[model samples]
Structures are given as C-alpha cells and as structure tokens.
Target: MKINKKIACFILSTALIFTPFLVNIHSYAETTSIDNEEDKREQEERERQEEQRRQKERDYYVAVEMYSDFPKLKNDTQNTLTVQIKNTGGSHLEKSKIKVSALPGEISLTGGSSTTQNIGTIYVGNQTSVNYEVQVSKDAKTGTYPITFEFTGNYGTSVENYKAYSYSKTFYLNITKTEKEKDKSQYKPFLIQNIKHPAIINKGDVADLTFSIKNPNDKPMSSIKVSVSPDEGIVNQTQGVFVENNFPANGEKTFNVKLFAQDKAEKKNYSIKLTVEPTNPTEQTDSKSSEDSNETPKILPTSTQYTGIFYNAPDKDEVDGVKNPQIIISSYSYGGTYVEPNQQFPLTMSFVNTSSQKVLRNIKISLSAEEGTFIAVNSSNSFYIDSMSPNSSVTKTINFVTKPDATTKTVAMTIDYTYEDTKGTALTAKDSISIPVMQKTLLSIDDVAQPQDVMEGEPVNISLNFYNLGKTKISNLKMVASGDFTVQGENSYFVGNLEPGKNDSFSISAMPNDPNKISGVIDFTYEKLDGSIETAQKKFNFTLNPISPMPDNNNMDDIQPPKHDNKIIYIGVGIAVVIIIGIILKKRHNKRKKSQELDLDE
Candidate 1:
C-alpha cells in the first residue's frame, strides 16, 4: 500500500508541471484570434463613416451660374442679370440662399433695396432662377465690372455638411461712356522720370536737376508755369529756368534746375518746391480751384548726396617714454652712435586719414625683428586698434634691445590700416617704417688665441679677451668651442654687468681624434645683460708625434762555448808531466851511481 501511494504521488507532480505549458499555448492562440476580429470590425466602421461623409457633401453642394441680357451697355443704359441655382445630388437640399454683389464704381441696383434673397428648398435634381436689375451710372468709366453670386445650401443639419457646401460664380459688366462724355477733354497723367543731381548737394559739388513730364490730354492746352523754390541753403543761386512756361496738350517736356551750396551751410539735404501753375491767372481765381490745382506739385526729383573723406596725419610725439614720432627708418644699426649695447630703444608707428570719412576700426599691426642680428622685445608683438575718425590719427610703440656683439643692424617695420568709406565700402591703406640702430662697441672679442699646432691625444686651449669699449653692463660671460673637437674644459664666469672700459679673459679646451690633422672652425656665443646674443668664430690646427718600436729576443744559445773540449785538454797535460818525471828519475839513479863513484873519486 505504501508503494502504490508513492507511484500516484509521482504521476500527480509530473502532470502539474506540463499543464501550465499547455494552458499558456491555448490562451495565446485565443487572444490572437480576438485581436484580428476586432481590427477587421474597426476598419469596416471607418470605411462606412468615410462613405457617409462623401454622400453628405454631394447632397449639400449647389451649382450657380450667372447670365446677363446685356453685359456690355452704354453708361446711360440699364444692365440686368439672371442667376440660376441647381442641385444635382441624390438627396434633398434645403434652405438655400444666394447673394449678389456689384463692384464699386461700376453698377448699382435700380429699385431693389436688398442684395441677398432666399430661394425655397430645392428637391433632388431641381433648378431655380432669379432675375436682378442693375443700373450703370452715367459718369461710370469705360471698364469691366466683375459681378459675383454666391449660393449656400444645407443638407440634413449634421453640422458638418453645413460647413462644407458653398458655390460662387463671376461675370464681367462692360460699361461704355456716352459720346458727349468721350468728346470732353481729359487731363493727362504725368510722372517725374528722373533727377540728374541729388536733392542735397555738398558745398563744392554741383546741384543740377532734370525732370521729365508726360502729357496725355486729348486737346491742345497752353500757358503752363513750372517754378521751384529753395527750402534751404542758397536760393535759385544758379538761375537755369524761368518761373513761367507753356506745354502743348499731349506733349512732354524736361526741365532743369540748379542750386549752389554755401560753405557755411551745415551738412544737410535741402528741399525745393516745384509747381505747374497756370500762366493765365484769369482761368481759375476761386480759392477752391486754386487749392485743387496746387495739390499735384511738379517737384523735381533728386538722389542721395555724399561727402568726401577727410582725416589728419598722425602726430609726432612721445608717449610713455616711447618715441611716437613719424620718423621713417629705412636702415638701423645696434651698438653704435645713438644706440648703446644692452639698451632697449622704443619705436613708434603712426597713421592717419586726411579725409571726411571715418577711418575703419580693428586695424592690426604686426612687428617682427630680422633673424640672427636684431632682438625684438616688449609688448610690441601685435595689437589691434578700434577706429580713427575723420581728422584723427593713432600711434603704437614697440621696444627693442641691442645685442652686445652687434656691429650694425637694421630694423624693418610695416603698418597696415583698414577703413570703410561713407558708402559703406571697404578701403585699405599700407605703410612701412624703417629704423636705423647705432653701432655699439662694448664687451667685444678683440682677439683670440687658437692653437695652430697640437699633438694627437692632447688638449688644445683657446684664449680670448673681451673688451667693454661702450658704456653698458654685460653679464653671463663665457667662452665656447664647437666643431670636430671635444671640449675638455671651459672658462665660464658671471662678469655681472660689466662696467664701461672694462675687459675680461676666458679660455676653453678641445681634444681632437687626430690632433695632427685637426683643422676646423669653432663658434663662440655669449649673452649680454639685455638678453641679446653675440657670436664669434675662429679656425684652429693641431700636430701630433709618432710612437717608437721595441727590440726582439730569439738566438742567444750560439754566443756561449761547450764544456767537453776543456776536459780533454786537461787530461793530456797531466800525462806529459808524468812521463818527464820518470825519465829524470832514471837518469838520477844512474847519475847517483855514477855520482857515488865520482864522489868517491873526488
């Protein structure tokens, strides 16, 4: 029984896990089907609504046509119009209203007081017509008048259809003037074509003006007076035209007028009144007629006036210890005459415009020193200026110091200025300044002692003497050598602002690879108290001694004697001595025997 219970529990747990997966799949499919059905219904509803809206528009729309029995009529005759409204829809159209409007100065309704009227409701595919009578004014001009009729209809009171359906029609009503009216004379329209000179003229410029007038009148007319009066400045100073003149009908004429500008006149534009008065004063004496004639004054046209350019030249003065003089220096030298070594001199550049127009602003000035010789200093790098007005000028200052060893130097400077004229046109001007620097003789290298001959693997020494011939201070004094040689040592000293008429000595060492063949140039550079650099060069040569050779040690055995020969000589000498002794002894024995006998005998 326990085993059966365990198997049943296992089956129940497995089913529980897979049941959720199956339920989820079925629910997803059902939801998709519902969504598709809803979308189809929504689309059908939208299409039905669109069709209903279009049918409503068709039912509300009304067509209108304008017809006139005599569209073209004489000014003395009466004109009539018949307006028709029709509905060509499948639904009934109701409460239609038609409005008729006549343009101004063309036609007027004869007896009818109202312009708009209501026509009864129109059934499907029905038409309605109404007759309107209008009279053309006798004095109406010969032109076409546009008459418009608007029709409004209602289809079912849906608020939407009431806003959409409206129609309109338009036609022209030509009205011709009577023969007697056309025969009457008409005044031609005239326009002033051009003016030769400006309304306002400068004091020295000419002020000539010319005007063209056209006459389009039908009949001939005479006795016309053209006059002009000066509102300011000199009045009619240059009399170019009389007060009275005559112009034939349908004829044109050009009149010229001139005026002079006085020197004392303030700069301003002058106004002149020109009129075409009647030469025959008896024609219209009433105040009303005279006022009407003067309404269209024949004023001479004019253009704009302008003044010339004017300005003053830059002044020559000193600003902040800097010379603001207008001096042009094409050539300059440092460390000479007017300039001292290690001293900074200030330079100024000036410019101006001598015209009436204001000088342009934002003028840029660039300053640069020539390479190698001149040393530029101070805030004179580059600057911008605001503006220089008429008769105004500006100046800029730059500071420069002279190098200690500088003999004679030249400084070149350029100036660029830009401005706009009275007409707002751009104008540019360029100028250049040259400054000459005086030659300075101070702390200069008088002479140098460079080695003419040096041995290989040995150091070469260079000796130099600097003389302070000028009145200035020299600092950071040192001697340097550069070339194919290695510097072994240098004599450096801070002379600290050398006083005038003082001298200093310095030396440097150089070791060459092949001193015997050492022949090259060396450079010496130093600094002055004013942060200027000085350079000098010298040529040197070196000589070297050759190394000696060593002795050899092979063949010493042949110089000594052998020991065996000495031993053989010694043995031979001993044998000879022994043989001599034996002979003497034998003789002595015989002699002894004999001597003994002789002694016995003696």
Candidate 2:
C-alpha cells in the first residue's frame, strides 16, 4: 500500500510541473502567429498607399461630361445639348471657357450668335455645365455629323501638365432619310446690297466708307465685324479696326469704315476697301484649333460668305454683263497615295466647272512636271475635252513614268486650262497637283566595331561605318551611342545629310564604369520618304575586366631573394690583406729567429 501511494504522488507532481510550461508554449505560439498576420497586413497597406501616391503625381487633368436631348434628328429640327466639364485633375482651371462648332451649315445654334462661352473658374474635383440649343440643317444627308467641343483654360503655373485643353469628345447626331432634298446647305443668306463712300480722298485726309448689308434669312445674325482696306498711295485709318453690328432677319445694317489718303496718294480713282467675315453666319464660329496643334487642316469645304469686300479694290473684267465661267481641279487621286520610283502609274483627276450658271466649251488642258522627275508616258501632256454643260465634272487619267534617279519628294504638276463660254469669250485658269513620290530606303552598316573585351576605367574607341545603299539622299541622319559608360568625347554624332552611295564612319570614346557592365548601342536615325523618323540600332556587348594593377607583395611572397651585406664583403677583403701581410711577417720573423739562435749558439 505504501509503494502504491508513493508512485501515485510522484506522477501527480510530474503532471503539475509540466502543465504551466505547455500553456506558456501555446500562448507564445499564438502571439507569434498574430504578429505575423499583422505584419503582412501592414506591408500590404504600405504598398497600396505607395501606389496611390505615385498615381497622384499628375498636376492637372480635366475631363468633360455631356448629354443630349436627341440622339437622332430630321431636317430643320431643333434640339438641346448640355455640356458639363469636370476638373478631375489635382489643380484648378482659371478663366475656363468652351467653344462649340460643326460643319458651318450642317448644324447651327438657334438662340446664340457666338460659339464662345466663358466658365469663369473651375475648382479642383469640381464640374460646370453649359447648355446649347442646336438646329440641324435642311440639306443634311443621311449620315452622322459630329459636333466638336473645344475646352480651353489654364492651370496656373501647372500649365506644363495642363496648358490648354481641346476636349475632342465629339457629340454625334445621326440623320436618316431616303429621298433627296434641295441642296440649300451653304446658301448665302446675307447680301452686301449697297455701298456709300467718297469717290476720292485728298492727301493726308481721312474719309468714311459705309456698307449696307441685308440679311434675307429667317434667323438673326450677330458677331459681325467689317473692315475696310486702302489702295496704293492711300493710308487706311481703319487698318486695325472693325465696325460691328447685328442684323435681324429681313433687316439691314450699315457699317462705316474710315480711310485716309496718304501724302502721295494717286488722284486717278484710288479704290477704297470693305471686307466682311462669317458672311451669313447665325453664330460666329471660333477658328478651328486643336490643343496640341495650332490648327487642324480642314479636309472639306464649309459655308463661306463675303459680307464685305475691298471697296473698289480690283474687279474682274466682264463681257456684255456676263462673268466668265470659272473652272478648277476639284480633286485628284492616283493608284495609291505613294508612287514607287522608276515606275509608271496613272493619275486620275476631276475637273470641275465651279460656275453654276455658265457652261464651258472647247476646254483644253495642259500639264507640266518638275524637270527630270516625271514624264508623260505614251501620251502628250495636253488633253482636249469637248463641250460640257453647266456645273459639270470631267475626269482624266494620265499615265506618268518617274525618273530612275528621282528623289523622294512631293512633286508639283502644273495644270493650265483654257475654255470658252457660250458667248465665245476665252477664259484661262491654272492649277497645281501635289504628287507624293517615295523611294525605298536601303542602308548598309559595318559590323559592330567595339572591343570584345573591355577594361574598367579605360576609354575605348568605338567606331561604326555606315553607307547609304539607296540611290536617293537621306537627310537628318544622326548617330547616337547609348550604354552604361562615360563618354570621353561627343557621344552623339550628327551626320546631317548622307548622299546616295555615301559612306561615313562614326567614332566615340567610352570608358567602362563597372567591371560587370560593359555594353553599348549605336542607333542610326533618319527621316524616311514620308517625313517620319526611323531608327536602326546595332547593339554590342563586351565583358569588362578590372584594370591590371602593380604586383602586391605585402600579403605573401613565395621566393625570398638572397640578402647582400656590404659590411661582410668589406671585412673579408680586409682580413685577406691582413693574412697576406702576416704570412710575410711570420716568414721574416722565422728567418730572424734562426739567426738569433745561431748567434746564441756561437
């Protein structure tokens, strides 16, 4: 019984002692696990914040929001469009404004006479709205028309990021119709009915010129500015000024312009001037301009009006109260946009009689090209056309062979035409066509001339040989070296121009900065035939070994050189001399001693 009690007591004591240790181990493990999870969460949060900070580096950017009442429209229908411009950038927009425009006659505003509207100021992360009442033209075709909105403003000194903005978010409207309608899209609704001015102004005297303009359309016109110009020997007092007025529908408005005769003004009917702009515009459309570019070239014609003219400036001669028909080259096209060198291609063109009332008869057209660039193939440069009715269009195709050594350029071809009206009055006009020619680029370059093995901190001369393989010259040729090294001289070599079959060598001295990194790239950049820049790069790789250093004998030496002692050599020589002297002395002393012994014996 006693042994059993003792064994049970020992087991109980062992359990009690290990229980606290096990609990402590579990608690410690749980704490470490919590700390790990927390650390992971904190790292993730830091990464997210850093990403947000980098994204917020933008100084300014403004976006636009728009809505329209009608997505589609019929002829002569009116609608409303609301534009909301938002400043989503990190800065503010000062003196902001918007301009709305469309094809001059395709769409117009009903209640406005100016396309520009100011939106004073827009704070950061804010928005502003503007409204417009738009009307579709009666002569619109079955197509989708775009309404351009241009937003312009400044971002204070942050103009680098947001100088001026042209939000090209075009609002489109679809026009669906089956039958054709009358072409009244670009009709002139305003007329310069009368002009009142002094017939002549004396020297150094200013005169007033007035123009009476009448608006026949149903809409009112505003934003009209008129100016007058002067002729030879005459000074224009209104040179930099304009007379502005508004003319209601079926109403008349007069503009008065001032002109001053110069001191040497001519007396024989010096013609005065009067000029008008936006002739029949219901609203004055701002000039088309893009933010990135000064102005986008217009690809299509729009409604144009001459509200004013240079009064008595110059006039075309008329025969029997009939103006001669005007003929022009409407458009032209070729096999494609580009013509290969030394190849024959057909150029198709359309000749249009611009006069709606007069007919052109017995039209003779002649063509001429640049010297040695193009030649008419199997046909003369002149062609004849028979009688043509009023507002008629004719097409002619001419085959042309380019010169074998012709360069890449836009060659201009002159077209001179002579035609007669119904009254047999001869009229002549001249036009020019731009023909774009392209010559394929062919270039050869020498192999990479950089050293295969490079040494750190040492400058190596890298050379590249390039030759123009094409027959045409290449302009704006440049050579640039890029790598992880320091350049000793000019790293970029401007070749400027390379003639056909011309060869040139470019060299640069580069010093490798790191032992592990030694590589370079030579890039050849030049403008192609189409005026687009192109680059051809040749990459070279080399291994950099550290520069050779003087021998370091401090750490350890294998063979020790024999040590020399000048004192020992000197002492040995002295000892040898002394031995020779002593030998002689001893010999002499022995002879003397023998003599002394003999003398003693005697």
Q: How close is candidate 1 to the true structure, as a TM-score?
A: 0.22
Following a full C-alpha superposition, what root-mean-square deviation does model 1 have from the true structure? 52.3
379 Cα displacement, candidate 1 (Å): 38
Query: Candidate 1, which segments miss by more than 4 Å at Cα?
Result: 1-186, 198-200, 240-246, 280-358, 362-602
Residue-level lDDT tens digits of model 2 in 1-602: 64446545655675586568656655765676666677668667866765554444343344555444334455577866677788876667787888885544677888755788899888887888887777877766434345677887766465454355445455545553323342444324456646666543334456676667665555444445555555666665654345444546577776666666554443334545455555333434223233444533222112222222122221156566555566667667878878878899998998877555678889999999877587899999899998778768899999999888777778998999998988888888887777888887777888777464343444565666789998767777877888988765446666666788888776665667665656878999997656678789888887655556445342232453454444455556556755765676566556766776898899
lDDT of 1 by residue, 1-602 (tens): 54345445644664575568546655765675566577668667866766666565554443434344434455667766677666776555677787875455667778864688888678876788877777878766544345787777676655554534566765545444443322122244333455455422334666666666554454333445556665555456555344423355567777876566655554333555555544554351212333557543232222122221111122244233322212112222333335554678766555553444444555555555444333568554667766656546666666767676654444555545555543445555554444555445355674556464443344555555667777545554444445666644332323334566886554455566564544555455656544578766665554545233222221111232322333344446545644765575556556656766777788
Among these predicted structures, which one has the highest TM-score?
Answer: 2
Cα displacement (Å) at residue 442, model 1: 93
Which residue pairs overlap in candidate 2's backbone? 273-311, 274-309, 274-311, 275-308, 276-308
How does each model score on TM-score?
0.22, 0.33
Worst ten in a row by lDDT for model 1: 303-312
Clashes of each: 31, 5
